[model samples]
Structure formats: structure tokens, C-alpha cells
Target: MAGLAVGAVVVLALLVLLRRRYVVARVWGHSMSPTFHDGERVVATRRRHYRVGDVIVFRPRSRTTDVAWRIKRIAAVAGDPVPAWLETDHPVVPAGRVVVVGDNTGHSEDSRQLGYIDLAAVAGAVPHRAAPEGS
Candidate 1:
């Protein structure tokens, strides 16, 4: 019994550490429709790298946005050539910045209007294979 209790404690501690590195966010709008819907929950893990097509949660620091957190798919990353769809001065995505867009282009307020999102603003990236809570 004592051995089982000790193992449980160790597992609990590991979960706590993992929780700190991962964040759960609920989709709030139609931006990610078809992939994620409003009220669906996703788990995102904070890591040193992110790639195009990976959906991520971030806080928009620009004056145009008021939402505390926004979910969008990465379109470009550092060293990648800028997508022709974007109107920006830089030919390549600058270091430490990324271009993000909504899967549903018509409803997303993304890098198209907001410009490059600072990597520091990114909370985490949701794996493409993870199933959302509400389906």
C-alpha cells in the first residue's frame, strides 16, 4: 500500500510539470471552422519550434485586437519565404516572428492585417492529430 501511494505521488508531480508546459484553450469563433469549432477544446504544448499548418494559440498585442487569446494556423516561420498573399515589407519571415492565418480566411483576423506575430506572444502549438474535446 505504501509503495502504491509513493508511485501515485510521483505520477501526480509529473502531471503537474507537464501541465505547466501545456495549455488548454477553447475555440471561440469561426476562424478555425471545419478543423475546430467554437467551444471545442484543444491541448497545446509549448515548445522551441513550430511549423506551418500547426494550429497555435497566441495573444495578439496589436491595438486592433482585444481578445485575450486567439487560435490560428501558422502560415510561415523564421527563414521561410513570405507567402505572396501577405502584404509586407519583408521578403522572408523575420527571425523570431511567424505568419499565422485562420483556416477560414473570410472570418480570420490574422497576420494579413496584423503583420508578423512575435514568437513571444505564442502560448503553444496544438498538434494536428489531437482530437478536440467537443469534436
Candidate 2:
């Protein structure tokens, strides 16, 4: 009886925590390949400070029918210069925006084609897969 009661309590706690703090999403494409594989599952926090080099899951700020969360690496913060390799006319990332890119740049569509993502559109930073709840 005690074991069952403890199990119920633990399940309740997990249900509440999953509802409030994290999102479990399955990766769907190769846009973020080499780092995150297609069909791999990821757990991301609801909100937090994100830094350059962090791989994040976010929806595009621009209008698009695609609703899937895209995973990409933050290449530059709000004020950093866009890399010359991007071949974009905009020299630097504008205020309140960040430039994200895929590891497979040649085959991926990211900030270079989609434009700087809105700071608010950042859904969350994906913590290491080994520790889903630690973040």
C-alpha cells in the first residue's frame, strides 16, 4: 500500500512538472543534422536566457504555414556581426534579434533565408539529452 501511494505521488508530481516546465518534442527533419538527428526526441524548457552556440527550438517569427519547431544553433546575438559566409547584405544582426544557422548550412534553410528570429519567438533552449529535467 505504501509503495502504491508513493508511486501515485511521484506520478502526480511528474504530471504537474511536465505540464508547467518542459516540452517534449520529436525532431522531424535534417535541418539540424549532425547535432540532432531526425526522429530524435528533445525536451526543452519553457523559457530561459539563451546564448550564442546554444541549440534552440523555436517557431519562425515570420508568417509561414509550417508550424514545426525548428532546431538551430545561435550563431550571433543581437549585436554581433553576421558572418561573411552568410552572403547577406545585412552586415550585423539587428536589435532584439539573433541569427541562427544549421550545422548543415548547404542543405538547410535558416536565418540566411528566413531572416533574424524574434527574441520572443525563442521557445526554449534544449538541455543536454542526458538530463532532461536538470534544465
Candidate 3:
């Protein structure tokens, strides 16, 4: 009986660790279509460094949408030249900031609309697709 209790406690601790190191969110818009579709579930691994072309989940500073969180692809990172299409005053992305955009640019409300995202606002990077449904 004591062994069973210890095993349960061990499992609980691991679960808590995993939760702190990862984020699971559901895609809600066509902004990332062709890559992540609406209604799809995705998992992101928490990390400190993110680079261009990496997909990430973040909390938007703007309240343009009702959703609590958003997913986008990194277009540029700190020290990189800002994309000309985005009308920012800075010639290059400032430190501790990143520019993100939707895969489907026409339908995305991304860096073009929200400006540079603070690294602190990011939840994590989508390292891979979510596990198969119902697994």
C-alpha cells in the first residue's frame, strides 16, 4: 500500500513538470491555413530561443480578437532586418522582440497588424505536430 502511494506521487510530480514545460492549444482561425488548420490541436515546447521560420504560440497584446492566444510563424528575430512590408519605425527587429506572421498572409492578423511581439509574450515554439488524435 505504501508503494502504491509513492508511485502515485511520482506520477503527479512528472505531470506537473510536463505542464510547466509545454503548452497545448487549439487552432482557431484560417490565418495559419495550409499548415495548422482551425480546430486542430497543437503542442508547443517551452524554450528561451526562437528563430525565423519557427511556429510559435503567443498571447497577443492587442485585443482585436476574442481568442486568448494566437499562433504564428516567426518572420524575423532580434537583430534581423525588419520586413519592408511591415511599416515599423525600426530598421531591424529590436532586442528581445520577434516578428510573426500567418502562413496565409492575406487572412492573418499578424506582425502586419500587431507589430513586434515581446519574447516574454511567447508561450513556446511548436516543435512538431500534436500527437495523433485519441492517442
Question: Ranking under TM-score, best-scoring first?
Answer: 3, 1, 2
lDDT for model 2, please.
0.76
TM for every model, in the order presented, reads 0.80, 0.72, 0.87
**Which ranges in model 2 have alpha carbons more than 4 Å from their true place?**
1-20, 63-67, 87-90, 128-135
Sliding window of 10 residues with minimal summed lDDT for model 2: 126-135
For lDDT, the strongest prediction is 3
Off by over 4 Å in 1: 1-16, 63-66, 129-135
1-135: candidate 3 lDDT, tens digit per residue: 999999999999999999989999889989888788999988988998998888999999977768878999898999999999889889999999999988888888999989999999999999754322321
Clashing pairs in 3: none
Alpha-carbon RMSD, candidate 1: 5.0
Which residue pairs clash in candidate 1?
A: none
Instruction: Give the alpha carbon lDDT tens digit for every residue of 77-102 in model 2.
Output: 87799876667778788787888887
lDDT values of the candidates?
Answer: 0.87, 0.76, 0.88
Worst ten-residue run, lDDT, model 3?
Answer: 126-135
Give one digit per residue, the lDDT tens place, for model 1 in 48-122: 999887889988886554567889989899999999999988889999999998877888889998889999999
